[model samples]
Target chain A: MAFDLTLLTGSGFWNPFFWLISIVVALILIYIIYAFGEKGYKRGTQQVKPFISGNPEPSKAGVHVRAGNLYWGYMDALKVYYAGLVPIHSGILTDYLLWLFSVAAILFVLVVLL
Target chain B: MITDFLLHHTPALLVAVPLLGAFLTPIIGRISPIVRKIWVMGTMTLTSAIAVLLVYLVYTRGTFVYVFGALTPGLAIPPDSGGIPIRIIFTVDPMGAFMDLIVAVVGFCVILYSLSGDEKRTGLHYFYTLFLLLITSVLGMVSTGDLFNFFVFIEISSLASAGLVAFSVEQGRAVEAGLKYFMISTMGGIFLLFAIGILYGQYNALNIAMIAERMQFTSLDKIALVLMVVALAMKCGAVPLHFWTPDAYSLAPSTITAMLVVVSQASLYGLFRFVFTLYNLTLNYVTIGWVIIILGVLSMVIGVTMAIPQKDVKRLMAYHAVSQTGYMLLGVGVGLAVLGNQAALDTYGFIAIEGGLFHIINHALYKGLLFLTAGAIIYRIGTRDLNKMGGLGHSMKYTMIFFMIGALAIAGIPPFNGFASKLLIYESVYLFNPLLAIIAMVVSILTLASFVKVFHSIFMGPTLPEYSKVREAPPAMLIGMGILAVLIIAFGFFPQLVVDSLVAPAAHALINQGSYISAILGGA
Candidate 1:
């Protein structure tokens, strides 16, 4: 009884057993809702195809977005941010060492003084 | 009787057996490649068993030391008898034993995964040799009580890992990545050696316990501390010092990439061992702790943000590895920050560090599984570009499930091991400072978003025409992945069991510096 398997995060406890059970119940509920609708829907047809601004995608490939295109807007939003962050990962060994030694230099002063 | 002998000699055997097996691999390969594979697997099984038994002993019997060779590292030397004690000590507290378990599990699984690589490659004999040696080095690193030997193990691991990273030499970039990893590691190793020399000059001792026993925390000591911190921080892929990580991890054989995750944690082990065990109360805890937290926060934010837009699956995972490493740093770093105030320490400090430590093991399993699944895809479909991968879930169902388990877990999703640790970290670090906790949570969200992109890009969508005939990963590879997958789920379902049984005791051992010192110096 002492070490019952419930993780006590400082503020609360997480019992995965309860979480798992709730998940199963929620899943059952989802299945029931799903079962009620979409019974007439068919697979491998235009029913599954994407509706674009006006027309259906021409082919399956047109609908399947490539991974390189997945995070376009996210990258767009973070252009300035990545500009600053990505350049530091210039893949140059010198710059890498510069970061390493630069950190060592700063910490050298801080550790000594503080 | 054999158990008794093993109990006494586990530390030495843990390092030595694999080292010997590594040297024997090429010779065994001469006999037959199959024979060499058997020999390497046999050696690892025995080593993993030794690790498990070591963990059991350390857990039940409390912390202990194993000494080998003639002269101790400037400790308890009979003054008149003369020779400098060149001895090595392996001290296995709960923490060391915890690290041993991590390497053991990851090492065994990676060896299994490497068999798939071995079938396609020619220099597999050399591959197994370096692999075993890397395992030996990490095991020795975690278990060693002496600083010099720890450095020795670090050097050996870096060399072996550099070789493995360049194993696919046909690709020019693998060579490039290996060179980068090698040079960075060499520089970090040099800094570490200089720091060790400084300590040796100041204290005349190479044993961690011996130095901790007599730490003066002078200015010279601070210089040495910064050097060691930077070196180990670089080794573990802390943000600014983490440039080598994505390159090395992305380019390494997937098996080696997985093992590299554990290897970085060994450095994390070294970093924690230094701060908590060596410089616990003698130094300015708050300043150093805050320093670690900042590094962690940067790693979390920068690493994840870089990950989101990456098209390369492994490189993307590599960035996330950098991000995940931040959580460990944040969690334990919080614990370190709170060390000055006994009330704060008692209130949430231990929980925070435990969160960090727990994350280490969790990260190893899921991250390793993710890498292996990436390898499996590369094996069948022959590309690491997530854009090129699709419908893999239809063909490679097991790998897909493993990837899901790993992805969900890494995202800190519930009913998984990552969530448990993240929750612990979130709640505890919130007590220390709310902003850091919020940053950690935001990082987790980004992590989930990035992994979602990965899942959609790589495994979702229709089975592309080119990959329609792609078979599942081989039995050995699936078994390798299955081991981690099972553990991930088991750990998820029973996070508390793992924490109570494995994590809390390790945290206790880490913070109780007096015990570590006394265990080594015989109550000085």
Candidate 2:
């Protein structure tokens, strides 16, 4: 009887299940901060030293993975699809309205019977 | 008597009021700079009030027919049975009224934003003039009862918006983008004209209801449907036909770009009016659903993929606009697919349709806010490039917060307005096709990732030396974006408010075809 009551009510907002989640979240956050602090302390002690150039002088590591080139490769692939949509200059405006008229007229006939 | 007049005149007023305002703007602009401000503000405010009144009246009194110059735009309301409706007409249904309310609200915001822009670039008087005309035409397209009237309004809007889009073309690329938009849109308009000619040949009447009455389906019907599908697909920026959208939207002034997003939506409205009201919704017509769904799925997949790589923020937002459109179309396509199924499927269809309609409203809010926020950023930083931007959050805190809110809402994150509507769409589509649902979910996840990237790159990073001098957006732009952000949260937190007030009525309008027919064809 107690189990059944707990199962149903526990699913609601005040469930004991939430306390478990909160404790887990707090522990994870604490762990992350501690790890960051340890990394900083190690760096200060020169235990994890920065890389040096061939001349034995320190220098910043270069960033790679160019973003612009990747985008160009993708665009090149889509060129075929773009080619098919070549804009045709047709100047017939009245014909479009006529199409609208006939289609709307047909539907009106059928739906009005409802 | 007043109710009767409204029933008969609301549609015309929807168009006429804005057109009149557009016309009066030049004269008003001559009086004072403040006069231009007052005219635009007052006209939009009045239109907004009228839209609310029109919506209320539609709910209470059912459908009302407004004849232009006493001419029914479509079917003739004869002195007796079997008489022709001689005048051009405007039909006010619950759906049309809802559209009016949307256009009015967004149109008002655009006008307000325009006020803060550089008057020389905007050409204050002409800007408001074109803006009002655009509003009028959009309202007219939605509310007009005649097929021809819809075309006229479409042209008015297309032409005026094209001008607005290129308004900032002191730069050559902007001009090129505008010209591209014009050429493509002209092609669409021409195709539409051909389709209309075929329709007119079949049925002499130009009024929508009358054509519905008089048209007898033939081989021409199929041809006309195909033509209209192509034409409207181009207009709505469906996957294969959507090329012009990004360039045009990216090149346009930010406020104008926001307004232009609604162009595709209005085209969707036109598509819906065509499909549900003009074509047969029976299962016998499986071809229509297949075509629409295929296009929708393509748009969903392609639009998001394209958005992923875009470095320009406005261009990225433009691609997202296409992807968001895919959501609306997906819902609509699913609804069409399940039209003739039993009550169970019908309920799902209604859910999908209502979800789609509701998403339109949600998209307008967040997307508009997103663009306005983008505008605010551009206003400060003088560029639309994301790579050029970093750590803007420190300088433009409020704008960043609001932009994040909008971005999250658009990504359909839970507890936001986008999520609520998208949830309904996902559930309903899943009921119909699990595969389609999977695709939609994949798209949603990708959308979320893309926006997260935007937020991180633009706001969360360390301050860039270049942007350290930048300040927050002006008060007016901030206020506009802030209002939309609040609406996003409010609607997100309490979806029932929207579901009850807007979605329910719209769903009823679509589902209860009998009510529409009876009201228009004259009582039972």
DockQ leader: 1
Candidate 2 error regions (>4 Å): A1-114, B1-8, B71-76, B80-82, B118-122, B282-284
Give one digit per residue, the lDDT tens place, for model 2 in B1-524.
98765555666666778789999999988899988888888888878777778887777777666665544443437566345555666777888877877787776776676677444464678877888888888888888777877888888888888887877757887777777677667766776777678778888766666566555656676666666676777678777567777888888888888888777788888877776666645323445665677778887877887787778989888888888888888887777777776574455777887778889889988998888888888888888887767678889999989988888888887567898788878888888788998999899988887787777667765566677789887776777677778888877766666776777687677655555555556531
Q: Tens digit of lDDT per residue, candidate 1, span B82-172?
A: 4233467788899999999999998898888777755898888899899999999999999998899999999999999999999999999
Model 1 clash pairs are B71-B87
Give Cα distance to truth, residue B443, candidate 1, Å.
0.5
In candidate 1 the C-alpha lDDT for residue B267 amounts to: 98
Worst 10 residues of 1 chain B by lDDT: B70-79
lDDT string, candidate 2, A1-114, tens digits = 122111111111112234346768989999999887753455456565545564553322112222233345545777675444223112233433343445445433432322
Clash number for every model? 1, 29
Model 2 C-alpha lDDT versus the unseen true structure: 0.73
- The parts of candidate 1 lying over 4 Å away from their true place are A1-3, A37-59, B70-86
Judged by whole-model lDDT over C-alpha atoms, candidate 1 comes out at 0.90
